[model samples]
Target: MTSFFLIDDDVAARCMLATIIEDSDLGRVVGEAEDGYEMEETVIRYAPDMLIIDYLMPKQDGIETIRRLSGLGYAGM
Candidate 1:
């Protein structure tokens, strides 16, 4: 099964996306984070198959998050 990690500042958005992804049988949510900064280490731990990050966030945006994740060896999408 496809595993997913979510990074979004909006709590409701996170929940909705997780539910939709799970319900659609597209993937499973393995982790979640409020923002890239808060989740850097945790996301690495989860090692999700895909990362759903918000374009805009408090601490870090999607691009920055991906950059950080890549630097930390998280090669997932």
Candidate 2:
């Protein structure tokens, strides 16, 4: 199965996404981060194939996060 990562700051939203990821057959959640600050490290450790990120967050938004991830050699969008 495909590996997945979630990047969002909302606790309830994260929980809901986790449930969806677990219940769906498309992929599994291998990692999660509450904000952009944790994304780089967490993603590197989990090495997920896909990332479902929120549009807004503290420290850095999804656009910046995507940029950073791209800089780190992540090709997903």
User: Which structure among the candidates has the greatest TM-score?
Assistant: 1
Query: Compared with the true structure, what per-residue lDDT tens digits does model 2 show for residues 1-77?
Result: 88888899998998898898789877888877889874586686777888989989989999898888888888654
Per-candidate clash tally: 0, 0
In the predicted model 2, the residue pairs found to clash are none
TM-score of decoy 2: 0.88
- The whole-model lDDT of each prediction reads 0.90, 0.83
Model 1: how far is 3 from its true place, Å?
A: 0.2
What lDDT does candidate 2 reach at residue 20? 87
Where in model 1 is the C-alpha error above 4 Å?
none
RMSD vs true structure, all candidates: 0.9, 1.3
TM-scores for all predictions:
0.94, 0.88
Residue-by-residue lDDT tens digits, candidate 1, 1-77: 99999889999999999999999999899988888885788988889999998999987899998988899998887
The regions of model 2 sitting more than 4 angstroms off are: none
Model 1 residue 61 CA deviation (Å) reads: 1.3
